[model samples]
Target: MAAGTLYTYPENWRAFKAQIAAQYSGAALKVASTTPAFTFGQTNRTPAFLQNFPLGKVPAYQGDDGFCLFESNAIAHYLSNEALRGATPQAAAQVLQWVSFADSEIIPPASTWVFPTLGIMQFNKQATEQAKEDVKRALTVLNQHLNTRTFLVGERISLADITVVCSMLWLYKQVLEPSFRQPYNNVNRWFITCINQPQFKVVLGEVKLCEKMAQFDAKKFAEMQPKKEAAPKKEKAPKEAAKPQEKKEKKKEEKKEEKKPAPEEDMDDCDAALAAEPKSKDPFAHLPKSTFVMIEFKRKYSNEDTLAVAIPHFWDNFDKEGYSIWYSQYKYSDELTLTFKSCNLITGMFQRLDKLRKNAFASVILFGTDNNSSISGIWVFRGQELAFPVTDWQIDYESYDWRKLDSDSEECKTMVKEYFAWEGDFKHVGKAFNQGKIFK
Candidate 1:
């Protein structure tokens, strides 16, 4: 029996394989994934841990007798019982074959497709679509092979089944929605059977299949971006050297301006005048000034109680003539995957639309759990038309279906109150509120 300690992160699908093997083999496997026992980033970087597992990746293992092992597959194989290793030489080779199949065929495409949905990786449309094809091919292979057999290599479950199932865990949980995975019926049946087993259940608990395919979340990718420190201010150039460069830049600008064509002699005075005048870049500059101060309302919403102060202030001071209320729903609800990722999408949109903050406010909400969710929000815009006047705001805006709401209608008020308060029946959403984000 292999009695040892496994070093890994919590809920790591890689570590689950070794833990599942230990369960079946009756090995004493103590998982060190939390504080005191182990701290992932810190512990893995330490010289002591690095000496045993040179690669520093997990699930690394240290046996009771000081036998050190690294790589999840190697550790899992070490912990597996004779039956799981396969009874005969031929069976052992078959087990190895299936294990290799899982790693080479299943994991790559699975990770490529699932990581983006979890917000762990940047999404590429072509790559993801190809990955879906690859996943289908891998599942098709498994579906055909498992058509008559109870397990991959032998009559009973073995390392092959364990490895393959662990490798496919994320794909099944995040992207393999019912309609998408319907073709692989045999693989599905086998997967359910393996997961429901005592050994697998001990490590994975109750596995939930994905009800809806998850999409790439831009918000998560943005949050994951590294925030670099500001560079030190550069010393000013010598005055004499700067003067000549400044004069040269000014002359270049003057020459460019002088090269402009004169307005057509026959052109109308209004048309020529309008053409000659420089256009202001501000999108909302054309809109009439409103009595409602967006900045003040934003402050109240942030600093005071929503129901008691903010909601009342909004209704009392709302400038319906100068502004408009609109309901926006994400067009691709069926493609939404994880709750956190969906929330990130909202955050990403808010960040990109920072320029629109002075003219607009919104309360976007994500509803439901991973693999089944929707996104919708109430927006206040400075003008009667949609607030996105320029292309920058149009990026994420076009993805949503926008509807102008009657500002004085009770139903609109009720929806706005619920969104602003981050609570309400939200009956139209047909899902429980998971989280919300504010654009101010």
Candidate 2:
């Protein structure tokens, strides 16, 4: 029998653990609940319980080997390897990538945007707006990438898709109304496909799409209020009694005089005067053309030593408005070379820059080749200069240069701008990287 027991509340914490349980149905993974039936603080916080998992957080795991793990992602990873590492190394790597992406990219905004709107989390109008924008931007990235592909990381369903889909469950259940999701047709399609998977269906039994909650409807509600009393109608006088027939004939004569057309000379003069007026130039003609730049990085990663140090520095000093970061990987090679180790590495880089959480946003993409096997894209920052400090992991100063391109340079500017606007071909690199191990 498998040696570990997983403990978590039923619905709140189930999704994260569900991925593993679904993958490893018979893998001796006992789920201990801390819900109403088995309260954590009320009854399960005994020394024995504390010893097994000190954090007291639901979803903690205690292994038969006596190893305890906290954090959903960590436990899910362990369970997944033992339960569902797939038939090949490449499949395993894709799973890791998607799982990391879910934790990093999806959860943050979900916590920030969806929860608040649902009243599950405190609502701050300003914060919610920002969160909405962030999520929209992130989803846009995902939708574009998903335009051509099916799963989060590869052709097949893996832990990555499972993880991300689980995180999104809450949004679908509470916030993704048809109005909101209509713009994200691809995301909706991919989500539907994922939820329909046998394992996903088993884990998320009878999951239903939620109707969007109206933000506020006080005015409309008020307008629908019933009137206290009926309004009195005003009486009208009879037409025959109101005016005499002779007076009506005189009124008709006056109307006839008014109906006579002005002379042709007067009409022609009016047309001539109107035709003399000058046309105005378009108001927006002089507006400065927006410029963009695409900074491509395509170096090979043999070991962590060369690029590890530089990535963090670049993230720290990265210019937020002047540049945008799109995490890119060779698509096909991504499912191949992307291992749990690499996923953790990417996650670490993102975490190191966590301080820029609000100031800057980042995303990842998986492209399908290895020769130009570039994990590269553009950063649309606010200024002409690349203000962000280069990290030790970065190859060389010359390798990553940011420049202002001609607005007319469609080829260069559009791709970079698309990365920022969350438009174009790159798929959403999942959010798992956001929570994965970060370099100090």
Candidate 3:
């Protein structure tokens, strides 16, 4: 069995391939991603790390016996057992073919389609549309191939499945909503099957499929730009002193060249930019400090009974003067198809509004069955103003119609009780409660 340490950043899908392979093969693989072991830019750029992995890109690997490898495919291949590599020469060749396909075919379009949504790349409408078509084409090919097969290569899971799944992970999670993925049923089934396996699950925890397709957020994109450093003041030396200084600098440069290290290579421009980016100012910093604690309510809602305990706590502690209640309903309910997809819309919205959770609490629910449903939710915000209009939480808010509710009104109380409890008759929605997701 191969025993080694893998160096990479956390949640890096590329590193997942080798980790999953190691799990299946029972290889003793140690990950060095966190502090003290490895830190992305600092650790990877170190002289010791660059000596082993010259390019400094990851997921790089170094074995106990001194064998070292870079490039995700190479590392995964090295870590795989014969069963994962292939059972025969032809099987191994086929595995290589699929791995190459994942790199050449899936990655480009996947990165282009998914990066902008991640706020790592600038959005270009024309380029994004093309990437969508390209992704569809790739999925169509996989769908056809997987129509009669459970796995990609043989009767069992192999490196081929791992590579392709990792390559498509971001795509499935960010853009491949149910409607867009409906045509590629076989691909969807195979992808789901692969991810659910013990090996894949060990590497990738619960993989939530995209409910609503993500869009490039101009606010998030702008926030990712590196903070500009102030330019240093320039000082000029005397005309005669300049020549002696230049010769001294040339001598210093020549001596330094003798011990020069490997050139630092840029890998994943977005990752580098994100590391250098500054923390954003809190959007709700100007709001008055409310006595209501959003986290405490969320904790009770999660752990305690909703109707008997959590609901009462919400009503008792809700600061009417400091906080405001609002009702939001999806404007395009007619376009919502699958129930799961509708739920995904709620999930996606909650994810985008993560920053708002400190000052907000919401019960966004999906109503009715597949092909016939409505989405409506009760939102509690720290201030009277519409939070989304004034904050960066505007990504999905425009998709829903918002109305400020009178906190003292009986109608508002009923809506809050039902939404928070997730069981009351939603007469306003006119549909049965299918599922609910909370944002706090």
Candidate 4:
């Protein structure tokens, strides 16, 4: 009976809950995503949006009668039929329990693990492994609960089933490969059943699970974040007390040494650095290409043994005279606010350095959350000299401070092992680990 308009990002699993609810209830739910209805980021920032949904997070619903709702669960419950919600008080509480379980028990680790694979956020291997285990446990519980029943609550499909299925949406599609998920047989069966329902199928067209789990793509994650225009450099305020002779000397020096790029060219260089270009080709053109395939090493690091085998193999077969190891850290940690935003900035920087990826390996980490975070990375690139110079990457390269890491030192060995494995106590920053973005 709840007729309204819903505003949320496309393919958002949260919004899918409300949409599926509307489909079953025969409610008039107009989705406002593009053009005359709504434009994300722009419209959501407007006064009207804030007035209706004070929280401003999506799956926001506003009915013609002026009833407004925020949060997916609230919007979903508002739109559902009495049968779906539950006919009795006890059943309704039971439905609410599953919904709460999904939000609290499932989402935290799910977002940490799957968001990176979707290129929405960064990855932390330790956090991801913990998430995989946490998810398996949650599914084990659900699988046991669903082993007998066809639906989560009662005999028919209910809001509990819809909420839990949508909650598992991204995990199944992004990180839950068959081999990883084979243990949760009943959970998989329930998920397929819930999604195949007419209402669910209408909102969620088709569900595709990962064949072989995809690792983080630093380039894609960085490029996916909305681009922020570089703020113009503010000219320093004139020194009110400077003598006439001093001003004249400064002006003369500025003319002699201050050759600034044109505004268009400045932007062009920054853009070109990230974009593919014909300016430079084959950075290793001077040296013979190493017979040791970097890809094989990467596969080993990703899937096979890392510290025990891969790193040793890397050193054993390393083109030591050709490749060099370097430690790189963001110089603007003081400017990073919000853990998520800081991670995104690092991702963007790595994306801008995509050309160097083939020549490089890095594990950049964010140390804290909002206003207290720092970004530092360990990089191993194809050449002895920094790979960014005389190339497109130089535009963003200046933003970082780089130090050559000695590949021979025991300390360097530890750093490479810890950072590359995405585990171990990171002794560098001396803070609890937050998350990491891989520049592979």
Candidate 5:
């Protein structure tokens, strides 16, 4: 067994540590705090530390193989090899894509938006604004893609969601104001789902949505500025003539203290004050209860069969009125086009499905071009019977297995049916899936 020590802050650094601990239960994972006070006499910065990690960064891992690794993402990748990596080559590739996307796209903007305000890094107004803009832009890209799919790469939880999520944990905790995240609803929903997972909870603890900080107001800020002292009054001359008292008018006045309000009146005032205070709404108020049917569509079609036979059949026979079509693609397809245009194609399908009142969600993916050459995924319809036509692909449907879940019992056939009817509590299950493509 190898001993791995992570030198980092508990809050921001715990996600990575938790992932490793949860996945590789056999390995010993220790926390070595680097907050100057904690690290003063720590072994992390000693000569032995330099031998392992020259940079002396927190989260450097020394494997049982005597191989040492640094960089949180890389270390997480190394740690999650068997536990988080997909069983197939394609699954592994999707994981890599998501991890890379998290590192390259998510971390930069998050660091830019959060670090300065926390006083952890130098503040640059222009850079912060630019970073926010970039963050929104990147979120838009993710939202557009995630609007249809549950997870990032594969059919199950993968390293991609884990790593990128870890990177953004800081921003979600500190920087993302409600006003900022609300517009990115899909992103928010996805993030909430990820953090709420049991494994994540163990590592990251319960992630609460931080209250949005008050915006800077110029007038209020000015009011808060310390007032300057007025120049000392000019000293009076030493010699002063005595003044005679003037003749006076006669009037006697009595001063009296006003009585306070009665206890009943005070109670009413307190009640009024309580009533006047604004209450915050639960962001998940609209989220449906977790009840759904998982429909698995397995098809083996040649390139020509997918385009010439399968796709048209799907559009024509798909239960447009009863079921929603989620356009799914393999996480590993090289021929797949990567552009905003392809994203729009999927978005358009979702829009059309919205008209049907079937409450269908769709996601498209291109996986495995890297780790494995194969790609696959499924379009999940949450209703009763799929109203659409089944083309050539073999199809199977099963309600969410209640036996596996610890939450609700009472077999939820009605709940599943209601999900299809767009009735009852409807929650988003953003599990990653392995989906194959259907060409039209």
Candidate 6:
């Protein structure tokens, strides 16, 4: 009965929640991504958009009656009728409990364990093992609960099942291999039953369960790091023992060196451009210089006391008006596949934005695993606007939601501490921090 526009990128799991609810309720939910409508990053980053959804996050909705809302769960519940939501007040409460369970119990460990396998995050043996144990514990609980139950709440599918299944979708598809998942037979059956529902199937077509458990490929991951050439060994010989043969060898080496051609004169246009280009002029040149030096802050935070000393020092000397703080969340999360690839995407962007390092300090993080994940970060830049310019090479910058933070706010202070420290439960994404890259 309700008609509205849902703004989000394609195949977003959060958006799928609303879409599935709309399907069951016959709510006219039009995807904003269709032609002449919305483009992730660009449209959302505009000043006009901030007026509507100030956070600039996706799965944002605008109803025909001028009702506007953000956040996936709220939008989904709004789209659903009493049947899909819950039959009774008790059922509704139970449904909410399961939804909360999915966020709290299942997603954190699931993301930590599975993201590294997907290559979105670098794997740490100790952390990954702990994550696996946590996942096993959560799954055991779910399996025990579902042993006699058809659904997460009551009979028939509800918002609880939809939200939970969507939350666990990537776990089943990415790293919950048969061997790992076989112990939780009840959970598997419940998941299968839920996905088979026409509403789920239509929204999430043909869910492919993981065939083989994807293990961390270390050598392949090592290859991703910039390699270092081995140091040449020194050969010691008595100077007096120098002979004619040594001279001949030196001649031979000289000949070999002579045989090597000089660097190529004709290079690709990109390389030529890069070579011809002077070191970038300071993009933040226009902004008033800050009294707080970034390098000092980095060294103090990294080397000195993190919370006790560094935080106090930062706030005491922070040039709030001169330097701006912004939160930049990765867009096109639906396009993210394989955990490693997602992390690589972040690394690649960081590498490409070589221009931003001098003026910006950021911590871009990869959360969750393959097929289901998100990349987001907090950026502190020299100027009051996004540091990266709009260009072909800078296209990736557009694929992020940017919001300025009030440096004086408690939320800003907390974000700085959590993001810089790379710890804390990031409630916005509903997943624990997996790994982060610091743009120092």
Which one is best on lDDT? 3
Taking the tens digit of each residue's C-alpha lDDT, what string does model 1 give over 247-365?
87986787777656442221212222323334347777777789999988876875567799888999999999998999999999889876546766886787556557678889887
Q: What does candidate 2's lDDT look like per residue over 1-440, in tens digits?
A: 44577765556533355444445544556666545444444323667777766755566777888888877777766666433545577777867766666665666666656644433332334345545676687689789979999876656765666677777887788777888888999999999998886766766777789776435233442332222333344446666557778987997787777655332121111122222223334332343333322221111111122234323334344444444433233333334343433434443455444323323334433232322222334543333434245222232223333444443355544454444333354333334432322211
Stretches off by above 4 angstroms in model 4 are: 226-440
Candidate order by TM-score, decreasing, is 4, 3, 1, 6, 2, 5
Residue ranges of candidate 5 with Cα displaced over 4 Å? 1-3, 12-21, 24-26, 34-42, 214-440
The per-model lDDT (C-alpha) reads 0.80, 0.51, 0.81, 0.75, 0.49, 0.74
lDDT of 6 by residue, 1-440 (tens): 88999987776777888999998889999998543597665576689887889977787999999899998899999999898788999999988888777766676667667765654444544445657887888889889989989988787888988888988888898888899899999999999988888888988999999998787665654543323334445466767856788886996797777655333222222222233334544556777768978767765664566677777888888887778899988878788777656765775676466455556667777777667778888888776666666223364777899898999998888888877666676667644324332212
Which RMSD values do the candidates have, in order?
A: 20.1, 23.8, 16.2, 14.0, 25.1, 16.7
> Which prediction has the highest TM-score against the true structure?
4
The window of 10 residues in a row where model 6 has the poorest summed lDDT is 264-273
- Winner on TM-score between 2 and 4 is 4
User: lDDT tens digits, residues 1-440, model 4?
Assistant: 66779987667788899999889888899998665687555466578899887755676899989999988899999999998899899999999999988986788668778877766654555557767877888989998998898888999988999999989898888888999889888888888888888899988998887788878887987775435445455567677765689877997677655444322211111232333234366657787677667766765665556678778888788777778888877788788776645655765676666566567777777776667767777887787888878455674677789999888898788888777766666677635334443222
Per-candidate clashes come to 0, 43, 0, 1, 30, 8
Better structure of 3 and 4 per lDDT: 3
Q: Model 5: per-residue lDDT, tens digit, 33-106?
A: 54553342244457988788786555566664678787777667666646476667887887777776775677
Q: TM-score, each model?
A: 0.53, 0.46, 0.55, 0.56, 0.45, 0.52
Candidate 3: tens digits of C-alpha lDDT, residues 187-262: 9999999999988998999999999999888788666644444444445655664566788798668766754534
